[model samples]
Target: MEDLAQMTLDLTDRRLLSELQRKGRIFNSDLAEKVNLSASACHRRVQRLEAEGYINEYVALLDARKMGVPATIFVEITLSTQADEVLEAFEKAVQRIPDVLECHLTAGAADYILKVVAEDTEDFARIHRQYLTRLPGVAKMQSSFALRTVFKTTALPV
Candidate 1:
């Protein structure tokens, strides 16, 4: 991954990124107006940013409750061994499970932490039975269910 801190962005580039972070679907003309640039110039900058990996792909955020997968579960997994092959196998297996939203290799008590979504407790139970237990090198698994979401945002500070 490119280190964002190493990239030197000018005022116009920063403005362009900030505008896009606020509204990813904004048109080139509208973005240009907001950032005080010509439409063509804004478009060129955006294309360059994408090519250079400063801007990743845009995606639509969905409502978990409306989508019938409101229950958010955080799971901590400990592996039997910290070997490279064990970690790689666990990661590859976790990626195939659809309910898993985010997974991270951690340093504290757990080898990995995962954020998962399910319809409810019953759905979570089913997922645990069908998927989590089947993950390779899983020596221990601990889970916590979120009662409510305080806030969530996809926008990154530019």
Candidate 2:
């Protein structure tokens, strides 16, 4: 398979991806119209894009507030050591935590950064007591709550 970095995206491919990112559920015919391609051609291009791993998966973006998980918390975790086994164990544990939306191994002061969501601070406290505290090799942890989200988007510029 061609590497994504090596693959060249033509203008039409970019347009198709941009449109799909904005509206994953858009009909093939509608997408064709928007990208100025015949329906059959558009279908083939979309299929090729997916096969090439340009479009990984389609998902419906949900409202966090409506889902009863409005609170957004960013946690910076510093493990006791940078040992490979400790890092692997910590990552494995985090993957099982449903509330942890994302986890990143990072450089700088913290070994890892985590994005967590919950119903509220109290719920987060429960999660902390249950999951975060039990994570392996944690030397320090700091969390910050987002008060408001002024801007948020799932679409990527293709």
* Maximum-lDDT candidate: 2
State the lDDT of candidate 2 residue by residue for 32-110, as single tens digits.
9999999999999999999888899999889899999999999999999999999999999999999999999998999
Per-residue lDDT of 122 in model 1:
99
Q: Can you list the residue pairs that collide in candidate 1?
A: none
Model 2: clashing residue pairs? none
- lDDT of candidate 1 over 1-158, digit per residue (tens): 35766467899998898888888999899999998989999999999888778898887888888999999999999999999999999999999999999999999999999999999999999999999999999999999999888988777786
The 0-to-1 C-alpha lDDT of every candidate, in the order given, reads 0.93, 0.95
Off by over 4 Å in 1: 1-7
How much is 1 displaced in model 1, in angstroms?
7.8
